[model samples]
Target: MKNYWSRWMFVPALIFLFSSCGPSAHIEKDKSVDFSRYKTFAWVDKDGEGRKDRNNRNDITESNIRTAVNKQLQKAGFEETKRRPDILLSYDLLVERSTVQNNDPVYSQPFTRAFYSPYYRRYFFVNYPSQFIGYDRSERSIKEGTVTISMIDARSGKTVWQGWATDEVSSRNLTSKEIDAVVRSIFKKADLAKR
Candidate 1:
């Protein structure tokens, strides 16, 4: 009985450990498409006109994303080519404003007070019990960023695979390391081992 209870308790703990890792990536792909035929890739937005972040940091963030994605794809035997490639790749980054609400419990402090009683004709001390009061509510604004990557067939112009990740961001642009992690998470969820 002891062993069975211990084993049962461990299952929930294991599930919680994995669930709290971090934000998860979402992926979509065409099941009927043959992924193995895709060997070379090129950027769909070659001129950067469709990018969201076209400010001073636009070039830096674009470089970070491209470097990370290229590294991952090359490791999987996919090459980047400027000629007529098998697939066209495109990525986008978007940051949006959000609000978070927090509520904390409010409590009353216990205390003792002295009072005069007419029946007892003496001073008496009474203790007051602590109790729940109410809740303190607050709201704060935050910025969240989402990165999306898409792979389309060059000849047919149909998207074959797509992945995206969303998380709280510190700035409008992501650093190189942050971009790498985002790209890595997206590719990790992709089932392109055979290709």
Candidate 2:
């Protein structure tokens, strides 16, 4: 009886293993920048709501987003500033708590198929245990993400260039490494555009 069940679970397991196979990201681009003479920058946290916690409007600012932005920008050869800069930069983080469902319809197919051979029926019946029960579940967690600078004209304060990227990072807290990875990727796009 136990052996009969394992056969049923083989396909679903295989289906799940193959289905979850890529990165989670979506980026939007703006291509109206006068890329020349826009190397200097000055920025600040403009969104008060971004710095405030959703619950109390006071518990936000876990990581200094501005500093992280500076790190990435400087690494790209843009100079920092105090007064008016050719570009003004600002950034904000967005955390969303949600559930991700796990589903693998073909996960159990292979195991079941192996057991069904003409000469192996009895062998499978004797050795295999209960099948994996189909219980589609969800992982509940948070998605913390960042939105970087939307370049503005220093003379007119009008946004001209912008790039964005997001990754589903682990939810303990935002790490500098994680932020750097995503930001660096977006900066690469800017560099590519320069060429």
Candidate 3:
């Protein structure tokens, strides 16, 4: 019985810990555009230059993001082409620090305490009244990172699909696998391959 009760109590804590760490993504796409028609894609220059530009301030981070996006797109049956492709894929990264505040309601509970009357020299119980305690507010600053991937129609130069994945930045930079997972999650939610 004790073991079962302990297990039940631990489940919620475990769930909360895991839920707080997972990455989330939001995807938006033009419903009118048929994604199935897009069979090939090419990377768009960050500065809209004729030639491929490596002007991204963080070369390593950009490389990792590009590699991960390429892998996910290829997995979805999109081929990278140099010639005029069906869609132009572009990605951007943003990192910023923000303060998050949590306001927890504080409540006071009624309680009974044993007291001794000095004159009577006897022990007596007194009821402590319950009252509303204000709120316990705490602020924490966190570094947040966002990766936005957009697909533009090569001919029209209009965005057809976009995905944004944001999460707390754990380190100075994210590893290749981490980037891959984030991109994959975004793509998975988009369901790009489905007709």
Better of 1 and 2 by TM-score: 1
> Any idea what lDDT model 2 has?
0.60
lDDT of 2 by residue, 1-195 (tens): 888898888888889885453223344434555566677888754455533555321223334455566776777778888877888865545545655667754233322323456675553433444566676655656574654546667888777766676667676355666666666666666663342
Q: For candidate 1, report its TM-score.
A: 0.68
User: Which predicted model would earn the best lDDT?
Assistant: 1
Residues 20-60 of candidate 1 have per-residue lDDT tens digits of: 66557899999999899999999876664545734335767
At residue 58, give the lDDT of candidate 2: 23
Candidate 1 Cα outliers beyond 4 Å, as residue runs: 1-20, 48-57, 103-137
TM-score of each model, paired residue for residue: 0.68, 0.58, 0.70
Best by TM-score: 3
Worst window of 10 by summed lDDT in candidate 3 = 48-57
What range of 10 consecutive residues in model 2 has the weakest lDDT sum? 55-64
- Candidate scoring better on lDDT of 2 and 3: 3
What RMSD value applies to candidate 3?
5.1
Residue 21, candidate 1: C-alpha displacement in angstroms: 3.0
